[model samples]
Target chain A: MTANPKGGRYRAWGLIVPTGVLYAVTFGIPMAMLLSASFARFEAGRTTPGFFLDNYTRIASDGVTLQVFWNTVTLSAQITAVGLVVAFPVAMLMRRAGPGMRLALMFVLVSPLLTSIIVRNVAWMLILGRSGLINTWLMDWGLISSPLALMYNRLGVIIAVVHVYLPFAVLPIYAALRAIDPARENAAASLGAPPWRVFVHITLPLAMPGVVAAFTLLFILSMGVYLTPVILGGNFVVTLPMMITDVARNQYNWPFASAMSVLLLASIVVVVALASALNRAFSPPRND
Target chain B: MTERSGSPFGYAMLAIFGALVAAFLLLPLVILCIQSFTAESFLSFPPPSYGTRWYRHVAAAANWREAALSSLVIAAIVTPLSLVLGTLAALGLDRGPMRGRGVLYGILISPMILPHIVLGLGIFRIALDLHIDDSLLSIVPAHLTITVPFVVISVGASLQSFDTGLEKAAQSLGASPLRALWHITLPIIRPGLVGGGIFAFIMSFDEFIITYFLSVQTRTLPLEIFSTLRYQVSPAIAAVSALTIAFSAALTVALMMRGQVISAGRIVR
Candidate 1:
């Protein structure tokens, strides 16, 4: 934190050169090509080089494209909201646990991440089927007259999404909650503030930065989500990412797909930037 | 420590919600594991009988064997490359007096922000242009774009808190700069490097989108599983999926536990 020696400059450059050069050539070049190719014309499984606004114009004017975009955005927002609401309490509980128990809990929560998205969603297919576990259990308990359709719908997608992505939401808020000096909360509690009040005034405020960070991450992830929605919701519900893949792979419409991708990426960037800005406004200056 | 100071009613609520959520998170994986062992022809949970039938099918499937090997080979190749490059970048930024370091840092981690589908499309587009599509080599760059960030963030965090005085002390004792880095600095941050390597390997191995976009002739395990599932809902894929889930969990725990104890090296930390 205090000093930088004059001597290590060459060594530093040596260290940075590989990834930097690698990224520039591979990542950098591809991105340039993508930007350029997005304007190219696509016909009969082939693309030709040219400048064209038709790709972007089609993305803008198509009613289905507009609806898919709106739906993706709204679904992402909803998923982000749900994940935060659910993860906040779990994170609070995690912070409340002992070290060993906390580790165990962490392992449990992260187990879903260990499974492939395909596997998890496949499992969801079985679990959310009309005769799936929830429905069957409910029927057994005389809580339902018949099996409820949970798969191949928005509700199915949302439930699976929330379950799969819940850990992303929990870890950040837990980090934020864990970082707080317990004395602040204790101070509020000891001053006759009830548990709810203390948490609202002190603990909740402290963890807000983490909540915002988690929300941003989750929102972007939900926006970019392709596999889970398609696997669970089937053809009926199409998110933009799914649409992009469908267009590129099936329709062989690279330019339109690229245009959609560019727009999706731009929107994600704007939202993330806003979220980070909001996070900064909510949190105090870094102790560092 | 004062987290326990909340009211008893609050603690009760925490316990109830925690159990419910944990169960919800775990139910699917558990069902899959059970369904994989089912002797029934169809994948109905609470199977009529259980056996090793599906497991045998998954093991004997030729395409699955190919896909699994491809995934491992690709991940094995990417892991060390990512570690070396990522460590170097982290070291350069952390120790070096580089201007515009934030910009450089952002550029390195930008892949994390760009959605998987976008990056996948970009890589696919470029690959098609260059006629490198469907090659294992083509998948490498895409995986790196995502995996390298984990290394940067992991090693960078470690380097931030590292006692640089140790490196200086080693140098002062007549160790060369590289020698000091190898003997002193690297040992202290070995956890980060190891952790980063593990994360990179898993990420590359588990990645389907990039693989989906790139690989056609040589499918990864995920691609194969996807195709198999798309065609039919057999328990054979469930067996493979369960095995993969086990392998992944085992690999991560084995690596993490075998490493030196650095609290920051853990994913959450």
Candidate 2:
């Protein structure tokens, strides 16, 4: 609606064309290929040249795949829940802290985001190994007689996933908390509401958008996360990403892998779609 | 804000909790630094003897050096490519009164939501069909798929907040459109561009899953470390990890000193 939008359209095209072409070749076309390949027939570790529903049939009929799918959903839900709980208090402190303390906390909190997940997992293995740091410390304190199985299990993966993705949850909630006016909380307290009551009634509802946004992000990221689970969950723990890789590489079943990939992508899309619908229905509007 | 935070009990709780979270976050980096100094090679909780032996071992590994160099070269290529492309797209979104802008913007950033393995596998399939999978050239596109979305999001944020009146004023004063952009628009958006570029570089440097599918002739440091850990880890693995952590910390400090938040981080803003 601005003046000279004709020129604007031409300018936009010039600026956008190169990236468009690049993505067309790299991402757009590849996605099309993925979809097409998913429905292609599979034979002897190679994709044949026609459409088939064998992949879908197998995915539906195989009880183990269903179990693994449920397991993945459960683990991701657990990680999102735990990460949100742990991140809430920290985000509150970050919002309320003085400048110096805030900067220090931000640096520490953001460090893990910058550090490679590989290194994080490697260090987790070192700390969670049978005779690792936790065991050594417990022994020193006479807390336990034998080392515990901490790494290469479901519990370890959950812990490490939470650590890696914690910041993702905290930052959004912190931003929301920071954006809240202090006057509202102060007014509530001045009107005789207790501190806890002020927080529960005023602050929590206002920060719900951020909480939802954070959960959505964490859930999606958890769905795609491969390295954390691979490093910590070992062989038995098969998330979709891991399973996709196994079918593609180890089994040399590209079509089946493509099918799984499509399923994973669809699941995440569905999650966000459903969440946003709920968000639209439930979230209070901001007049600002 | 005043009464509660001033109370000793509240202050103590917040401070202690903050410190505990920081320690939890840095626990791995701290442990890696310690492990790199251990003299023994078999991996023990406490070092039998503390020395620079593992660091020295890492210094001598030719493959490790090559992997590091390859990573740098790829990141060097990816950063500028992503920055230019991303900035332009952001510019378009900012300046153009185009229809379906939302649709266009969504398409531009959809790769961010796509799973890495899916993108990698899809790109790999295409590359294999094109017979380009055996070259380092092929992997750059794969890396870009992941990094470009970050650039668009970051640079787009900066562009959205930029004032357009200055550029219009420059144009009225006889400055060319490109000139106004160069002299006014670009400078204002420099922080965004720089932040996007840094993110593009780091993401490319650390990317392994995409490279895993696409890498045939070249290997990056993360790929090397992954294999090393998966098959057999030497004490040198610890050293390599420590060195990368040091690099990340130094980069972080440099950005912090300049007061730049590198807003392109996947962490929600």
Candidate 3:
């Protein structure tokens, strides 16, 4: 047992064993259990555990639930799209800035992420409040006579969430942009490719991987977000998380909540798999 | 190359967008700070007169003090625990001979991807089964699910770039494996640990869902602010929010500075 090559390997395994056990018990088993609980029925504080289709059937039949699902997908897609458009130019500017300006811009972008989500939501509430900043400014400027309904709506939730998640969107794109070789752009220019053409044909394609990664991250995050919707959307908008909350807490339907969670988890897995597949499809094959 | 002028239009567009984003980012904190100085009790935007009354009120509240204390205590415990566990996991995966290491890594990091509401529900059910629902002990473990992944990623990134030959050299010099790790590896990786620990601390401190679901008797600062926001819209809430924002900003700046120093040191070395 003294200093054998295999003995060192065993030692490493020994170090990892405890953590592996913790992850297995804490995360792995519980996730499997949750998946199973989804198909069962919980009624009157008693869960009848079995394979049942009613829960899935209920999800399909409920119009409001369907609408909420659609809203979640559409909102997530819209946010990802809009986030990319807004972040691209900013990232370009960031890439072109001096050292001090770059640091300042990074801080400005990252500060929103540092602020508590609840605080950001409250800020949105105040801004979208009838007498809050947006409406007040609009009214004062004679843009509109009456206060617009901004708070406790889908639009407000989207605005707040976009603001909250913009940093995530910006940083990745900025990294991708910065990683592009400036010399290549110059070469392309010398080869008679104009600035816009070089950007479209070369830079944008190189940065596509980051765009995909950012979109996937943002979309999944937006799908599962709880606080922004709860605070800003009120009862007007119902996403998957809100539905889960209603089922688990208000209705005391643990099985229903579990069902919703399973659906959410499955969709996320599907999205991630699709993203990876797309990435592989788009990635250039290595000679090695 | 043709003489091309600066695009004033582009600059103006960037400037205006930057200003709007800055306002969106900073106005809430500003409003909260100003409201904290208002003499009036309500959460009015424009204060008739300025005073430090709300700060006094926030400081005077025993519940606020207790919540803040609990938050500090929880963050203190959770941050170190997450750093150790996360670092060990990252190191083990980085160096281990495990089969399907990629899949294992994915599983390790999956907690971050899972909807926290789901995590909350799963943990709540488990806590109920274990009969530790609403205890600080239960809440600490729940927060670990979120914070540990951040630590893992940060530590893993550093570990990926770490030089292994130094450790081997120390081992060849008759230093015990543990001593080599302590003297060689630990110092090199200390910055990652510090940065990851700061992230873990913030994650624990600002956590709302797990604490909201798990804790029965103890409420962290975020939970307090959450409940306050839900039930009322007071200048006091604004004041508390302002303080939390400032605290978070300070921590972030400190972490960024530490990261810069570490990277600069790495470059110099």
Candidate 4:
């Protein structure tokens, strides 16, 4: 690469200044405000500006909030787990498919992600609601006498979340699967190891990086989910973000909401750190 | 190496599993599209009759029209603003001094992963204190925080594969920097630009949570659909949802036709 003239270096940096300024105004200042507000006190249904750990303390002792937090964590884990199971086979298929087949598979997966979350959830409501497709078909076929309690529950939320996040799970695993040298598996096969054994020993270990990455990504996204729970869960299921929104919007408890937001952000940080540590622990030793 | 993919049994299992997963992905959208054509008032599978009555209803509703207009206006503003900002940030990251590049890149892209509800809560507080809560003044900036990351990442992907030699050659021939960039660099990165632009537009259009926090009198298309869905399971919503699906599907096709403008991996990453 040719060295740019001295003036060009500064110009290159200058290009970033606009975005930096935008972030400062939009993201940076607001986050700072949120952090400070989390320390403020709320009493008698009014928020007073001052330093207090009351909000954080409430998160621990208030009892209801932490349950919802745990519920959110459990739901996120469930979605991530289910997503990995379904996505693994699809990723494997993508790795083996021809270019045309791969593109078609990518289209099916990515199109859902690009579609509006509300639209996708609405579609799910039509498919899973009382008079929706599955129920109607079941009743018509005499398979059941009544509609299943499919929508408006944890199961519906999991199904919808998993559907949306499946692509997130598949792509990374597929990338990792493609990155693997087939020769390793072939070598294992030539040594008289069966296909499933080779997969267990070679493919699964090699694909761990992508699997971990997908889990991290899915869990993070699932934790932040607000609309899916509201729409698909019929507001019967409350996640962390749903609680934060309810507090801030309906209750007007800005400090409490801000505190919850901080907690959510902290949990995300922990997840990221844990995932990276796990990635390091599970990584195969490099040969080169 | 290629012949060692197990027996026909394994292939059959994978194929069956893959097809099932694909069906799972497409079933909702396909069902919604079919349900949108129902002539009946409420949602039901295998709709009693097929017609465009809901489409007519959506077209006739003033609130739907207004929300769609507001979304378009906001997306119209957000698209160009974010594209310019994101491209500049991406360019700086690619060509700038090689110090803290990773940190800077992470910071720029952090908005993508940061929970929208948290960001919405922060923006809501600030907007309320400023008394600009329900206006474009607050909403536009909120949209920018999220959409800019897509542009940065997508454009950054393009810039990574870009060759600097052509620009250097143009400069050596006495072209000014701006002239060389306009004539050489812009065309080469057009695919990224197009992809990033569509991404920004769609994101701003579909954004719900932050807009929900910021808007009281103002409603975007998704907000309208959400409110409607919350209160009533109307067939008109199916029509609106169908339109949105079509909008995304058409744009996705455009990206595909643009020939590897952005991959699902790059976008997800």
Between prediction 3 and prediction 4, the one with superior DockQ is 4
Question: What DockQ, on C-alphas, does every prediction get?
Answer: 0.52, 0.54, 0.37, 0.69
Candidate structures ordered by lDDT, highest first: 4, 1, 2, 3
Which tens-of-lDDT digit does each residue in A115-160 have in candidate 4?
9988888888888888878988999999999899897999999999
lDDT of 3 by residue, A68-181 (tens): 778888877877787777777777777766777777777677666667788777767766877776787898899999999887887888888888888777777777777776
TM-score of each: 0.93, 0.94, 0.91, 0.97
lDDT of 2 by residue, A1-288 (tens): 236768756667568888898899999899999999889988776678568998888788887666777778888999999888888888888877888888887788767777788888888888887767898789889999999878778888988998888888888888888778787778788888876787788888888778888888888889888888998888757888888888887787888888888888888988899778867764765646
**Which candidate model has the greater lDDT, 3 or 4?**
4
Question: Considering summed lDDT, which 10 consecutive residues are worst modelled in model 3 chain B?
Answer: B260-269
- For candidate 3, lDDT tens digit of each residue in B3-101? 221244655676677667767667776776766677886655677788878888989999889888999999899988888888888877766665656
Cα lDDT for residue A231, model 1? 80
Clashes of 4: 0
- Per residue, candidate 2 scores C-alpha lDDT tens digits across B11-81 of 66767887888888897779878877889977675678899988888788888989999999999999899
Where model 1 places Cα greater than 4 Å from the true spot, the runs are A1-4, A41-51, A139-145, A284-288, B1-5, B255-269
By TM-score, who's the top model here?
4
DockQ of 1: 0.52
**Candidate with better TM-score, 1 vs 2:** 2
lDDT of 4 at B222: 91
> Which regions of candidate 2 fall more than 4 Å away from where they truly are?
A1-5, A285-288, B1-12, B231-233, B262-267
**Rank list by TM-score:** 4, 2, 1, 3
Tens digits of per-residue lDDT for model 1, B86-111: 99889888866767788878887877
